[model samples]
Target chain A: MRIARFDDDRMGVVASDDTVVDITDLLEQYDPLDAADLLPDLITHFDELKSELESRSASGGGKSLDDVDLHSPLARPTKIICMIGNYREGTDRPQQIMDIFFKSPEGISGDGDTVILPPHEASIFHHEAEIALVIGKESKDLSRDDAMDAIFGYTVFNDVSARGLGREGINSFLGKSFDTFAGFGPWISTPDEIGELYDQHITVHVDGELRQDYNTSDIERPIDELLAYISSITTLNPGDVICCGTNHQGLGAMQDGDVVVTSVSGIGSFTLNVRDSDARQWQRGVDEEMAARVRAQGQEAPAQGNGG
Target chain B: MRLVLTADDRIGVQTDNGFVDTSSVFDDIRFRTAKDRMPRVLAVFHERRSQLEELAQSGTAEPMPALQAPVPRPPKLIAAFGNYREGMDGDRQKQDLFLESPESVIGPGGTVVLPAHEATIFHHEAELALIVGKRAKDLPADESALDVLAGYSCGIDVSGRGMGRIGPSRIGKSFDTFTPLGPAIVTTDEIADPQKLQVTLTVNGEPRQNYSTDDMEYSVVEILSYVTGFMTLVPGDVLICGTNHQGLGAMQDGDQISMSIEGIGDLQVSVSDPHNRDWQRGIDEEMAARVRNRAGSR
Candidate 1:
């Protein structure tokens, strides 16, 4: 099922490519006082609510997808964890231990939102396209076998990064946390809708020009392994996001007035407008040199801590 | 005005007589300070200050319940790295800061669960935490960062050492229950000069970190301005001033930790390590010595 939030906190099930069945009334039973609490509450109780949602979706007659402004399906997630260097880009390097970092939850913007490049002296800003996991239940110390059960659905995330920000020892906090930097939407595609999370083609386009074209098969760590490792470190709450890191191959700079579209095969596509007030520029087109340089660096050393 | 959250997650005000459960008082207006409404704390703190004060003055006093972090689950929990000018020569290096998981936050009387991660040591950093009051970004040259202040509180930054020697130090700092903040949020009016405040930390009744915010390399305003340059800080966002590494020491299993700032009241928590990891009982002389030597060399 493809669940979407649109037009001022209204809940709906996308009935077709262009129509959304109103399920906002179905959520009234949850007794949420505010719109911010709606999505998480719905997600937590989705099991019992699934049958009704399916019926309403089948009963069909609702608004056109174009008449309403779509919002991020998950509102107010407590954590937004993003994996770092979890892809190999078809390189022959050895596997490095996995690592993850965080982006401010407030940085999340929905589909069709604007990515405002903050006024900072950044070398360049690049959009990293990756599939993100929306956790279904509170989880901790999850084994790889149980990790897949913790996932509610998947959405495409743009791990927008600011280049030349000196992320060496700082966990890339400032570089990846500008408001509207973590854009994901369109809607969430549940696991049932997306069979086999692997081998799906992930792609990104800037101004109608393809920039990122990679397959999830290039992912260095399997989805379950990534989920299990992160859960061991901290608790994952319902609606929390875990963005699978992207392959750097075909990465490039994003500038003012650029329309960037990101898509994953079964999940559908979402568009974001990039606006840089400073009007600073970088060499356009794919930064193949940087991509090759990153690939040439080989794999990072294995993680040292006993946390793994 | 002092702000607090009860164990039931209701908003309250600490009064001289007792406590005022502000949750019910503000319920008609639909004010919620529950953990679920954490993102809205700053907005409430900013927009309802005067009304909260009035409610505190008139409400029937009741004993406060178990406490929670005043600004629990801030949208951003940014902490300074090596920011104090005392034990470490902070000026010798560039200004740096890192983000900690909001899930790491535990309120007063909470237990700091030391993860089973292998580390050379676990350190306790006591610092004065500033809670942002308004939405701010790229604080203009004409404005004072202090104008954006909401209040202050005591914060304990529980850090794991030796894990991120080759990369980002956040992993060591981002473990669950690594940040303990609270007791109460003392409004800005209660603190005349944040830089003049004293910060101290004790582990199992032993003195560890004791210093004045005066030793900070950058003033509170400077840190706010610098941070706002990177991204927008909305109400209730926490920016913890870095600690003076002097008097910093190791924390181990079953240790009682207490952190106090001059005006913000005391924040006490216990440390629990499942692996029962042990480090030297006194100050971490090795790290202090390293910084001391580095400072002398510079």
Candidate 2:
């Protein structure tokens, strides 16, 4: 099922009208550990809470998502493993090189969020639309089959990168990790239902025009192998996220006031804003064509520019 | 409340055995004192018992401290690089001089402050900051050297920029409170594979940065081998593995940087302003006098 953790840090199923029940009570009642605990424990017990959420959705009635703020799906987890060049066109290197790239957890972000571009230095900050898997079990030295079992769900992630932070040239952690550089969520779909994990058509748009386009099958190692490769070395704890990699076309950038839209077929899409220091430092420059696309997709209205 | 940091070109530390005085760790070494005296800390591992157990048992040596740093500020920080085809595909070229200064580095229990400018670009990267456990000369085999690991600590390298190509990163990464470290160091015995732990970071209670040790292009063994080849890695020297791909994001004032490694523990720090500039004569005199007075007190 499509599951989501939203509204100032609480978990609940997203309904039709965008109205939300305070599932915080339900998640807490069913939670084996405090929401503050590590995410792996929560994922393991997620099924234990499943029936309870269904009951709450049926019995409780209060509050609306419109009235609350959203947070990244996983409250707190041990790690956010990411793919560097899994996308076909993400790098300047050859195909085999796609097998190696790294992003730390600090790169994650979520919906209605801002990608704070650094002002102290001159660098290109870009958004990458990628699929991220949230592991549900502690997995190590696992086979590809077991690795797939460890996956709890999938979510959308915007991996922001600060290019050339240093010329070390090898490690991208410094250049790619700036606070709020990574963005994910909107919702997470569970494993059984995450049929879109692979073979999903993906696309990224900045302001309005499409930027990145590809499918998950294009990833160098694919999800199962990537999971196996990682499990061989380090253990992946539940609630841990792995951004498989962004498609090739997602590279380059999002200017201030620009809205980035990344979508994966079957899963849905995420809309985020490219914000700068000065509110007006950027202009969406969207007037007609963008509005039509938003309507065609039946997505929510874009966040209005705050005149920064 | 223990803390370790790479400051003034070396690892600065706080320990149970008094301050490590990182500069002193190298005093007995044969290298030039100017270069050898980088402030830092080093822990002698138990595996090296054969080499050090005699000195330790005979009362000829003191118990190692929990944390340590270089006595002098590090000239630069580097990690394994992967820009080229050979580097990206694990060619083991040792060309990955891939290191950058933390936007700020502070001892554990110390606060690393960041400037608040919605206009300034910002981000934080969680990484493994190695505190050299011993002094090893000549490039030893990866297994022979890493086998002597004293312990490990957690740290973050914060960066701030308004543009895309910020270089030297030293100024942007070295603000007070920008790099927060300490809490505790997991002695090597407590850790099995240094390259196989969970590395993560959170800001204002949000999980922003995360990744595991195995993700690095160059394994810790490879990195240490390459690093030691350039010079003797003295005890208490810190090597910060550049952050993984969580991506650079943003932070305002009052943000907390909690960097953690699964078995190694975490260093949680709050952000604030450095307000650091030139020191005043009167203040300096008082501080100098305080040191002078304290010199006699001990």
- State which candidate has the highest TM-score: 1
For residue B38, give model 1's deviation from the true position in Å.
5.3
DockQ of each: 0.31, 0.03
Docking class for model 2 is incorrect
TM-score of each: 0.91, 0.49
**Global local distance difference test of model 2:** 0.53
lDDT of 1 by residue, A41-60 (tens): 77888989999877777666
Worst 10 residues of 1 chain A by lDDT: A299-308
In model 2, the Cα lDDT at residue A95 comes to 43
Return the TM-score for candidate 2, rounded to 2 decimals.
0.49
Per-residue C-alpha lDDT of model 2 across residues B134-231, encoded as one tens digit per residue = 66544454666675445667766665533111122233453435555555445566677877888877776667656677766666666676555433
lDDT of 2 by residue, A204-297 (tens): 7787787767787766667888888666434466666778876544355567877888777756677777777754342333323432432243
Clashing pairs for predicted structure model 1, backbone only: none
Top-lDDT structure, candidate number: 1
Query: Which portions of model 1 miss their true places by more than 4 Å?
Result: A16-18, A59-61, A66-68, A166-168, A298-308, B8-10, B18-20, B29-33, B37-42, B58-65, B87-92, B141-144, B164-166, B292-298
